[model samples]
Target: MQKVVLITGGSKGIGKATGQLLSENGFKVYGTSRNPDTISNHPFKLLPLDVTDPNSIARCIDLLKSETSRLDILINNAGAGITGPIEEIPEAEIKKNFETNFFGPVAMIKSVLPLMRENKSGLIINVTSIAGYMGLPFRGVYSASKGALELITEAISMEVKSFGIDVVNFAPGDVATDIAAGRYHSPLKESSAYKATYGKTLELMDTHVDSGKDPMFIANAIYNIITSKSRKVHYKAGEPLQKFSIVLKRLLPDRWYEKMLMNHYKL
Candidate 1:
């Protein structure tokens, strides 16, 4: 039987690329967007899904179940980005970011587990970020939210192992996508203490995204993980240096790592 796969935030970017690749490879691929109708002529089917809303999540799964009868793989790629100094960002914005990045994926996983348990096999890949491995200046909230999801994947992987289900985190470095258009950015106030440094770092962040790896790079990574016989709990995809940064963090002293990051951002 062909495996049924659902990818959240599937209208564009990495989600779209993964869906297209998987569909071409012979899987039944369904991707979800908040307003899927807005997009037409997509390669794979698009379902309506808003991860921030439990009702939307439930509805999307119900729709998928109605047609496919089974969901073998789920890609929790739905996420929102936020950038600002920790002190300047509003409490509500932080919570909203969590709703999309952390709580949303948790809800999706919960909704799918019952069916997966019944079938006695399933795979879940939570799309995380290289930024999640460490706190970065001006992007702390985004890092924290993705970091929380990474740890949750670890916990879920163990809990569901007995049920023949697998959960893993796929953390990617910067990728070229339209994510910046939707990112929540705290306004740069000229009088604010962090105005100059925050402004510079913000530009640098955008530069990385614009020049980052192609989305297909991540899609290929996901494809490999799905086809692999035995998978690890964590996998990362991106530039060698970006992947190496994680290793460097483990090796470098606390203050030394901090200094290195500061210099990278030209702080």
Candidate 2:
């Protein structure tokens, strides 16, 4: 029996690369995009899905159920980034970040759990970020949302482990993607205290992302996770330094860790 896998935000970047790779690995892969019609030259089947909308999520899952009797794996990869100073960012913008990055994946898991539980075996992968561990300087809200996702994945893994459902918090550091294009920027008020600093920080962040590891770095990680027998709760993917720093951050003192980050961003 071929394993059925669904990936959100599969039109581009890590999602696209993962879907393509998973299909090549012989999984019955379905990739979702807000505009499925726009997905071109992809080997995997495209499904229209909007994770922020419950109705859209339900409809897409139902469509999948209609075609396949079971869904073996779910990859919650659909997300966006927001950049700006914490105080200057609007409440609505922060809410939007949580809606897409956190709530969307939560809703996805809830909707699919019954199907997974029925099958007695399944894997759920949530795409979080390294920024989630230690909040980024300017992208505070974005980091917070992914930080929430990291915990969500952890909690769900504990609850579902006995049920034969595997959950992994898949955190990727910098990866080359169109996420910057979709990123939102906080309004820069003329009187904003952090206006100048935010601009420089955001620019440096963009530069780091522009020089990020390839999307294949993440795609290959996902492929390995799905195929492996061992159950790892968290998998970090990216350049070696970025991936290893998760350990370094934990071992370092609070002020020292923060100072390291500040120095990296030239703050």
Candidate 3:
């Protein structure tokens, strides 16, 4: 039987590329977007979904169940980006970001587990970020949310292993995507203490994304993970240096690592 795969936020970027690639490789792919009808020329079927809304999630999953009763793979690719000094970011925005980046993925996993468990085998891949492993100056909240998802993936993997459900965290570093445009950026107030530094860091962040690796790179990684029999709990996809930073964090002194990051961000 062809494996049924559902990917959230699949209208563009990494999700789109992964859905397209997997569809080509014989997986029955269903991609979700907030406005599926507005998207055109997508290779796989597009389902309307909004990760931040529980009702939307329920509806999307129900629609999937109606169409394909068995779900072999669930890729929680839907997430939002937020950038601002932690102190300056509004509490509402912070909560909203978590709703999308953190709680959203958790809800997704919970919704799919029963279906996966019933099938006796499934793969759940949460698309996180290399930024999650370390706290970057302006992206603290975003880091925290993704980092939380990373840990959740670890915890849930062990819990579901006995049921033949494999939970994996796939962190990608700075994939070239339109994520920058959608991110909630706290207004850069000229009088705010963090204005000068936050402004520069914002520019740097956008530059990194503009020159980031192709989404196809991450798509290929996901494809490989699906085919592999022996899977690791955590997998990262990115430039060699980006992936190495995670290792360096493990080997470096805390203060030394902080200094390196400060110098890199010119903070």
Candidate 4:
């Protein structure tokens, strides 16, 4: 029997790449997007999903349950980045970021867990980011959302281990994607104090992403994790610099690490 895999935010970038690669590898793949109409036809099925909407999540799972009796893999790849200083960021925006990046995935996991538990085997991959490991200058909100996800994945991993279910938090460093282009830009009226400092950092970050690793690299890493007999609780994907950041966090003290990261970002 062909293994079944479902990926959220699978319409583009790493999610889309994973869908294509897994399909080629013989898994029945289902990719979800907010606008199913815009999704180009592929071998994998495209399902309409909005991570922030509970109704949308329920409907998607219902369709999946009706079609497939068992689900082998669930990839929570839908997320958005909100860039701005936390002090200057509005409460609404912070809540919005957490809703989409953190709560949405949690809801999806809750909906899928019962199905996986019944099947006795499953893998849940949460697509976190390098930001989860440390704070970034202007990306405070994005980092916070990912950091919360990292902790959530850790707790879920421990809780689900006995059920033959595995939860992996996959953290990809800056990948070349339109996500950077789509970053939320706060109005100047709402962010005048830190605008000058944050504007330059955002520009540099954008430039760095323009030449970052291809989304296929992340897809391949995820493929390996899903197929391996032993699953790791955490996975990091990106260039050498990103790996260095993780190492730096481990080797240096908290104060020192903050200094180094700020220097690196020139903040």
Candidate 5:
């Protein structure tokens, strides 16, 4: 029997690539996006879902339960980025970022755990970012959201390990996606306090996003993790430099790491 995989935010970027690749690999894939009509070319079924909305999530899962009865894999790949200085970002925007990036996946996990527990077999992968590990200047909100996700993934992995459920917290570095250029920016009025600093940092971050690694690299990494027998609590995907950076963060002193990031961002 072919395994069934559900991916959130499957309309574009890493989610789209992962859904396509998994479908090609023989999984019965179901992808969710707010705008289901936008994903016409994909082989997998597309359903309307807004992770930030609990009713939307429940309805989507209801459809899945009514139709498929079981799911083999759940990939929480839907997320958004908020770009602005920490101090200058509005409190509401910060809450919204966490709602989408952190709570959204948590809600999905809560909804699916019962089904997976009954079957005693499932793979849950949360698509995080390197930002989870290191704080960036203008992307404080984005980094915080991902950081919270990392902790959530860690805790979930421990909680579900004995139940035959595997949770993989996978972090991919910068990818060439709209997230780089399409990050939601705080209005100037809301960020008038730190415009000079926030503006430059946002510009630099955009540059990095535009030139980042291809989304296929991340798709391949996700495939490998899902197929691996041993569950990994953390997986990092990106350029050689990014891998090195993760290692450095693991081995280096706090002062040294902070200095390195500061130098890299020219802060």
Candidate 6:
């Protein structure tokens, strides 16, 4: 039987690329978009899913179970980026970031595990970000949410390894994606004391992204993870620096390491 795969946030970007690549490789691919109708025609399937909605998640998983009998891989790729000074960040937007970036993926993993346990085999990939390693400058809370998801991915990896279910955090640095266009802003960010630096920070966000790696860079990395005999708990996808920055952060003293990051973000 062909391996069955499901990816969230599949309407575009990394999720869509992964779905296409897997489908070409003979996996039965099902991608989820909140607005499936908005997606253009594609070779692989698109399932409507709102990862933040419990009912929506349950419904999608149940539908997958009925159709595929067993799901071989689950890729939690649904995430969002919220930008602003930390203090000025709205409570509701912070919660919204956590809801979409962390909680949604958690729910997906939990809902799919029972079926994976029954099969005694599966791989779960949590698409995190490079910012998760540090409290990112303007995008601090968004970083926090991804950081939480990364830890959750690690914990689940350890807990589920024995069940033949492996979970890995795929932290991709600035990939070229429409996610930039989807960025959310705090209400009072422009009026805050950090206003002078805020514009520059946003410019930096775009700079890194415009120079970022391709979505296929991530798609290929994930493809390799799925096909490997055994996988690491974490894999960074992007330019050499992205994959290595996390290593340097681990190697250097915190003061020095943070200095490097601070310099990069012009903080």
Candidate 1 structure quality by residue, lDDT tens digits, 1-267: 999999999999999999999999999999999898889899999999999998988898889888987889999999989999999999999999999999999999999999999899999999999999999999999999999999999999999999999999999999999888799999999999999999999999999999998999999999999999999999999989999999999999999999999999999
Assess every candidate by TM-score. 0.99, 0.97, 0.99, 0.96, 0.95, 0.96
lDDT of 3 by residue, 1-267 (tens): 999999999999999999999999999999999998988888999999888899998998999999988999999999999999998899999999999999999999999999999999999999999999999899999999999999999999999999999999999999899999999999999899998899999999999999998999889999999999999999998889999999999999999999999988989
lDDT ranking, best first: 1, 3, 2, 4, 6, 5
Which has the higher TM-score value, candidate number 1 or candidate number 5? 1
lDDT of 1 at 23: 95
Compose the digit string of candidate 2's lDDT tens values, residues 49-117: 999999999999999999999999999999989998877788898898899999999999999999999
Write down the worst ten-residue block by lDDT for model 6.
Answer: 183-192
Tell me model 3's lDDT, rounded to 2 decimals.
0.95
Which pairs in model 1 have colliding backbones?
Answer: none
Model 6 lDDT tens row, 116-207: 99999999999999889878788899889999999989899989889989999989999988777897976444457987677778888888
The better candidate by lDDT, 1 or 6, is 1
Model 1 misplacement above 4 A: none
- Shift in Å, residue 110, candidate 2: 0.4
- Per-residue lDDT tens digits for candidate 5, residues 1-267, read 889899998988998899889989989999998989865677678889999999999999999998797999999999998887676678998998899999999999999999999999999999999988888777888988999999988999999989999998999998999985556787655438776666667678888888887888889999999989776699998878877887899999989999998888777
lDDT of 2: 0.90
What is the RMSD, in Å, between candidate 6 and the native fold over all Cα?
Answer: 1.4
Q: What C-alpha lDDT values do all the predictions have?
A: 0.95, 0.90, 0.95, 0.89, 0.88, 0.89
lDDT of 2 at 102: 97
